[model samples]
Target: MPRSMTLLVLLAGAFLIAGAAALWLERGNAMLLDLSSSVSSFMCL
Candidate 1:
């Protein structure tokens, strides 16, 4: 595979892992309040 394609695959895998970790840490709140709070913070800017 090309270097760019390999890099893209690695980045995607890392993103998935990080997302899973955030959800695991947030527990049930991951789907709702977590996203809402982050959006709200962005809106405040």
Candidate 2:
């Protein structure tokens, strides 16, 4: 039982590290566009 608990903890820690790494790698790859121009166009219409 103790061994299984240790394994579970290690697995959880690995998942957390992997998730953080993915976010760090993707931080600059993700793009957000300016929506104000589109909103203004819609308002003009």
TM-score of each predicted structure versus truth: 0.59, 0.58
Instruction: Quantify all predictions' global Cα lDDT against the true fold.
Output: 0.90, 0.78
Stretches of model 2 off by over 4 angstroms after superposition: 28-45
Q: Largest TM-score belongs to which candidate?
A: 1
Candidate 2 per-residue C-alpha lDDT over 6-37 given as tens digits, one digit per residue, 9 for 90 to 100: 99999999999999988976773443223556
As a whole number from 0 to 100, the lDDT of residue 36 in candidate 2 is: 58
Please list all clashing residue pairs in model 1, or write none if there are none.
none
Score candidate 2 by TM-score against the native: 0.58
Model 2: worst 10 consecutive residues (lDDT sum) = 28-37
